[model samples]
Target: MILVQYMTKSSITELTSNNKKNKVVIHLSSSTKLGHYRASCLILFAFSCVSSDCFGELMEDLTVLSPKAIAMANAVTADPPGIDSIHFNPAGLMQFEGDTLELKLATFDLKNRYSTGPQQVDPTVKASYENLTQSPYPQDPYANQQGATSEPVLLIPGGSTETVPFPIVPLGGAATRNAQHQMVFASAVYSPMMVGFSRPDDDLGRYQGNETAISRITYFSPSFGFQVGDSLALGLGINFSYQGLALRMENRAPQASAAILGGLLSGVSGQQIGPGPYDDVATLNIAAEDYLSVGFNLGLLWSPLPWFTLGLAYRSAAKSNLEGDFSMRYSHSMQELSTELRPIFPKMEGVEFERGEVKMEFTTPQHMSLGTSIMVTTKFKLNVDVQKSFYSEWDKFTFDFDQPLDYLVFASLLDSDGQDESLTLQRNYKNALSWSIAAGYQWDKSLLLRAGYQRRNSNIPGNALDLIIPISDADFYGVGFAYSTSEDSHIDLGLGYLVSRYNIDYGQSNNANSDAPLDLIYNPYAYLPIRASTRAFLLSVSYRKPF
Candidate 1:
């Protein structure tokens, strides 16, 4: 029988129990011991934020906040976009002379693709794998040739991983500039980082990440702006957010150690380790949330010439220690192996289903954006922006389990500093630079047309790429139209499409290939080249009026 304990410390509830085995977290503080704040229905509804887990792999410009911004491909650092300027360039808030309210809605149609080539491995390892799975009494014939799955999956907080339907996300904010017109104040709600995905229990991609992995990062900002000089504007914003992460994935030991064990088992007493080293031996499901994530934004705008405007914005970094529940189940094969090893290895502990509190630390890298807008003519303007992210702060993720883990015990053989109560995933991401250009045409007194293109660079090194978080350098194209509904009210409509692709050679990705001995949970297609493609379609609609 398995036991589990649920803890709620956010004043909504509280508890303590020893049920089974549980593990979690990169952050554990008084908050970890204090409790969880049962979120409202709204929080649950918004959990379906985006599928691009931004914790460390932040795609800073999903820029999903404003219709005008999206339509201009997020090249708004110099021109700003309604209340959403709190993120692009707070200084732009000064442009509003009185109280104004804006509403926005966005939708994403995301699709992913995967393909595999011939296996590329040392001849000896290949022989061992083929012998154990192909020439054996029981075999997985399709093991050598895996197919592709375009279906998308999502993590259901209180439930298991499941397929997701079309999702439309609602986002917007309100802001006002006092009568003095020298100062401006505004607030808005938005999503800066988020992503999630899932695969069938049998999908080959499951080997890299099975089930569903999710991340929720949202922001509510209150900002202030000052017209320092006729041509200079400054702004400051305090951003508070709710950050949560939930994940469910299968685990395996696909290194040479497991293949060797498989070969030995095939010739010996026949105690099944698995069909091969590539099979699943354990599964982990964890979920946690941090209601209070804090950060800030600073911005400046300068118009040195009537036709040229320059702007700069800086976004601060944040750290969150999420608290949540976790459950891990060890397979019967693993249990059997534990039982057999107990005689000689008296220190080994037999493991079963475990449930307990867990903690994980997450970080949002600091970043800066600079841009310029030039009015080529009274009716035409061009905007260009450059952005830099210090993703080097995201070196690794540390998951702290409430109890010792058997997998960690066995993992120690391959790793020199393995700890039974913790596991660290090394990302080794690099700093990235991205840029965009946009043009706007005032065709009529009440009609404006805008078009833009953006280049998004990849932060994941070539060796760290994987299907679960399959990101590559990408291109974003956008077009938008703004129409004046009345003198004080206007309507904006935008459409955007983004495309990215990756072609990883056999054993190129350290995260999913068998070329690395440290590859613990992945390597189902160790020797096979991989191809991945992603296409995202976005639509935004907005209406604004003075209040």
Candidate 2:
């Protein structure tokens, strides 16, 4: 049976005394659970504040450009259409004349699945606790043959090299194991004289449980444009954005199998580890208030020839002031535990505790894009865009501790060495620049075909450091079609597919008998090959009387 203990300590010293198995006391003073809570908050704060989006493989596949623009580009020449092309190549918008405007709406069905191999677990740490409990001792046991020393055979249940004791996930909560899927989109465009807007709602933590989260990355903007001359166009835009976040945490235990525990322990020999309250659940509710912010975009589109167009766009960065309410729901049994569980399943003695709220703000990065498109022939055209992410803008997250026992609490868990550090989490984000190239062919004035490729690198830390961002390389393939039904009526269709694969090396930070703590040794595990594919079909009819 998996057992979890929650306790409050007077100081880091109190934690060390009862830590028999020396489960790296999370933070240092409080139980590992609390330390994780603080750490997760700190990390999210770091990501939100830093221009971190640029570093991941996810950034390579999707851009701020709307789906309609991507679809149109894929359907014909990557020429700009609608104002959306301003972010890719504003020059496409220069093709519009008279009182012309285009309105398009789209949805992005985003799904993310994750899995890791047990080999990534630490064998020499508390994570290896299960090895001690396997049943059916090795036959002709090495122990019986005196003086003949050989490497001891360690058998764990179900072939798991080590079992995680308690919970010391350095990558936030187990909730990450839960799959996340959602849909969000924006549709807006303008002419040389008028503008309009429509933005779909964003769901944060939709995939990680119903946690409250302000989508720090959500964006909404409206824009206006004017023609400078036959070859040049200028546009200005205003951005209004909002962010809110809520993290829902449920009390959870390690994913230890009963068979593994049964075989590891000598005291509970031959006893079946039955399912019990160890699998119960409790909830932690975290709510961050919504914050409003503003920014702007400036763009220019140029077309020196009918076959070639170039564009540039810039967006400003803004900060959010966030505040929130935090509370936890406790299961009856969890509330009764007076001692904390260490790595070795040892119990800490005489601990007490209380819970409360956490608050902070996260920064979203600023970005710029330069794009170009060329109609190589009457039937074929190529388009390219290069963009830069301002990750340096994100730096640190700070918090205030006003509780009576805050000092003792912080010291024991987060800063055991008495560094007297403020509640600040540190991180560095690498600024990233990425590019995309696409090509399309026209079979007739009424028929078109397209195909494209894209690639991006990852931003995960080295094999030695453990961080939560699971960035990796990504590759893409896309095709689209457009059919003209009549001189004034038409239908359009497009599809895009993206694939991401990773051979990551992750370590379990929970090993025993070593300064390294328990670490899941490095091994390769393939998460779900992320797939971002889209299918879109559009129908429209229009008329223009001679003006």
Candidate 1, residue 26: the lDDT equals 16
Candidate whose TM-score is highest: 1
Give residue 483's lDDT in candidate 2 (0 to 100). 63
Clashes in each model (backbone N, CA, C under 3 Å)? 22, 40
lDDT of each: 0.64, 0.37
Tens-digit per-residue lDDT, 321-406, candidate 1: 76777666767765655555444334457566756675777777888999999999999999999988888786776767677544
Candidate 1 lDDT (Cα, 0 to 1) = 0.64
lDDT tens digits, residue span 107-215, model 2:
2322233332332223322222323333332111111111111111111212112212221111000000101221111223221100001111122111123321123
Task: Name the regions of candidate 1 deviating beyond 4 angstroms.
Answer: 1-58, 127-164, 210-219, 252-256, 262-275, 344-347, 518-521
Which candidate has the highest lDDT of all?
A: 1
What TM-score would each prediction reach against the true structure? 0.83, 0.58
